[model samples]
Target chain A: MTIPLRTPDGRWRLWPGLALIAALAAGAAAASGALGRYELNVLTTMLCYLVLAQAWNILAGYGGLISLGVSAFAGGGAYCVALLASHTGAGLPLTLGAAPLLGALAALALSVPLLRLRGDYFTIGTLAAALALQAWVYNWDFAGGSVGLSVPIARSPDLAQTYLLACGAATLAVGAAYWTAYSTFGMRLRAVRDNEEAAAGLGVPTVRYRLAAFVLCGALSGLAGGLIAYQQIAFEPGGMLGPGWSINALLMCVVGGVGTVAGPVVGTLVVYYLLTTLLAGYDAVSLVVEGLLLVLIVRFAPQGIWPLATRYAGTLLVRMRRTA
Target chain B: MSAAVVLNGILLGGLYGMSAMGLSLVFGVLRLVNMAHGAMLVLGAYLAVLITAGTPLPLPVAGACAVLLAGGLGYVLQRHLLTAMLVRGANGPLVATFGLSLIASGLVALRFGSDPVSIPTALGTAGWSLWGLDVRAAYAVSFALAGVVAVALHLTLSRTRLGAAVRAAAADPRTADLIGIDVRTLYALVFAVASALAALAGLLVGVAFSVSPQSGTSYLLIAMAVVVLGGIGNVLGTFAGAILLGVVQTLAAAQFGGGYRDLVVYILFFVVLAVLPRGLFGRRLT
Candidate 1:
């Protein structure tokens, strides 16, 4: 059975969808001024996670490259902002501007080696790269060693501003995902993901397509990291470049739905609220619940909650129509 | 670098090899990268520590119990969880195991606290001089134990009916099943044996080096490096790869600083994976 894209009729709907998203994002940003500090903080954090989840979805869901080292890019971006701010006394705009570039550059360099690995090996390779980056940062005196570095408070964006930046980033991330969903590029990518050999045999540049997705995801992850740096102010390698980032991204993507454009958005909200907000002080319990959820999701709903819910809803609609 | 450091590295490699063997076995048979392998090792270590510290049991007895328990846990995990996941697709087992690792580590941390702990034994601190090179008693014992296990495992796989069945199953599950071989039972048995080996390695690691609940990831990375270097599913090659990794790490630490050791290993792992996906040993068990 050939499954069609969400909008397979034409690209005409893309313009309206883009405009609607822009309006919604602007509306959210404008409405954020009325939110208290706690609500703002939570929303900002969720937005950042939305960016991460979306970025991860682009790579793993569409690209078919299950990277376990997303922290490498996210941390790389945060470090870029931190170092730029500290060393050159760069403004927030400049620091944020450089973050995605740094992330993209790093992905480009690593892609040569990383993209060579296939399937499970690729996952292992990305994981090693992240840990290696962390270990290197721990020993490098230039990057403040294990003590970590702080973003210049004077140059940093305040909570409200950080939220705006995160909103913008999340919008871009979602836009990217939407584009990948309907565009010919995304179709080619899905083709590569579904069957590399067949795509290659059909003369698709599989490696190039995969690399493009990898780099694009890296850029988005880095932007999210930059926003995180602005929000946290003082961050360490352990917190920034830790496995937690990868875990969070993976959990959000898997739980929501893998490969679906709307999955990460739903996943980010569900996971952020269910695990982070509800179980704030209970670290162990949170982890246990998170793990159990992951296992259960993969076992029972491997296609993820988004797809499962939609499928069930479709069936229910069919039954109602038949009865009518 | 002193001769002693290299000697110590070789000794440490024995434990690394033993730890990696289980991971390799699972990957070789099930083609599933058990992301919980390191967690299983940590669990083994914690269980041994709990038994020895809370009870009057000797360290050896505690170690044996931990191994047995780990094996049983592996059996259940494979039979119930992983066996079902295997049919779904590739990502199912990987994600499930990742979740399992999280659960294992979280549970361990909740029970034991996050602080690093080790089993204090005379062997841990005692030393012996062999040809003017100092070797810790724990290292020596672990190395010897690893060698013995390797030899025994080799013999079992090569010289027994069970070994033949396992080999046949690994070659092709469907074909073996058609020929009256119970592939599911054999898989569980293989996973159990692998878990037992990992537990043995964990016990040695606990005695020789401290382990915390979060130590599973590092151990998992080390096991992955060794498995890749030794060639996946090649048991003997795993031992050799572990030794090479140990030597490389030790030398890198000596050349740079102690903090850079993991950095070097991870870099090496990435490079090797990119360059030699088949592994340095260039051997396939199946």
Candidate 2:
């Protein structure tokens, strides 16, 4: 499942991926003028998802946690930052700093006990944490309870700036994912993912690596959540901490390719686009489509779209070499 | 605060324990983390709601139909979808079941809408007083039913041929196959039984409280927490864990205001995980 990004043959598939992202960003920018407010909102949301999906990949695909509580981090970031911003005069910088910091602290605190939970237990524990957190947030008066907290800052109603900022965040998120995936740490992460016991037996410090991945994922998701609060100008506990967010992240990674740098990007785009475009008018259609995609991918394409494509490409290359 | 409140908690714990038992059963046999177990419970409630809508059928019959519908779904999915994923080892079924859960949720939402619907029952309004505490008959009935389900499940596992097959499958899948037991069929049965249990729990809840599309996650979380805190695949452990949770939540609500119940539950879960990783009853299934 190791995708060959660099080789003696030097196919350099990374360039094509970067080019595609750049082109999409540029195209999105151009469309900002022509697109309606509704369309812009969808695109911006897609970027928020991009950030979330990538962070989730870092935790589940790379690290062996398979956490179902990434939304906890995101929602924590959203509420923490939104509340601070509205209540204080710290502005966006202080709010943004608190988002990742609070999220990281939460990760550290949760992971201490949570890291002890492995596999399905870990997933369930994280989910319980998320649900509990959501309930807590909903009941907290400071968080605006069920009514949600609205940001006091003014912004363009057209959402062009928000979409553009989201694009940049998506790019950076993908970049961070690529950097980490190609690093030595990433190799260890894959090793851990493949077999934690085996990796630990080989002195892989599985717990530490897993914790690091969780924190990284949590921070990124928190940042995304903060950004979303900025864009939407509201931080609803239901919106941030719901199972739907977790599902979307898992769907994106699984559909595009789990354990790959580019997988979440592609998966998020496809899933988000399908929901916003193809199933635009239908109610509850997104859930069905995403659910079906997850089941199908887990059943049929556990290696995901990227690995499948590379396998086909390898076979094609072999055939070409034979002909030559 | 009084005998009835404590009694009510105990009764609710019965259903909670019953709700989580099927989940424990599935995990024990298939080694899958079915995130949709709560969704299954909700589906059961939905089925009960649908069946009881303007029907002359007795409450028990409607409850049975709900359980049956859920059991049927479990059989279909286990026989068709989940079995394929089981061949690949642990994580396959875990992810697949999660996906199935999402799909089920979507279907339920699409069919039922997001609105909360309560099952109308005269028993819910009826109650008895004992030791200066008020008690609802509906809660008591649901609780008693849950206890029966738990006892029945335990007997089935310990006494029945199918129970033996399931245990054999759980103990060693390949060996079970070698012994001429249909591992596939056993899993399907396990799923059916689990689904039935979930539906029963759901039906009980519908009669007692309210059912909605969004309520599944809370039930699922509590069930999973109970499963983990009880022990990964231990049934008796689930009963203990659910009761422990029921008490913890009820007490937390009583003390810290209802808002902090979750905080307390999570803290309790964390403490259990930190202190006893294998849960309070970590005994390996015999």
Candidate 2 C-alpha lDDT tens digits along B131-245 = 6677777767876776777777777887888778888899999999999999998899889989888888888788778878777777877777677778866777788788878
Candidate 1, residues A1-324: lDDT per residue as tens digits? 844324666444566667777898999899878999998898999999999999999999999888888899999999999999999999988889899988888889888767876678778777888898898898888998899989989888889988888889989999999888877899999999988899999989999999999999999999998889889888888888899899999999999998998898889889988987699888777778889999999988998999989999999999999999
Off by over 4 Å in 2: A1-42, A154-164, A313-324, B54-56, B130-132, B260-263
Candidate 2 docking quality: incorrect, acceptable, medium or high: medium
Model 1: lDDT to the true structure? 0.88
State what share of the real interface contacts each candidate retains: 0.74, 0.79
The TM-scores of chain A alone, one per candidate, are 0.95, 0.85
TM-score of 2: 0.90
What is the lDDT of every predicted structure here?
Answer: 0.88, 0.79
Interface DockQ of each model:
0.77, 0.67
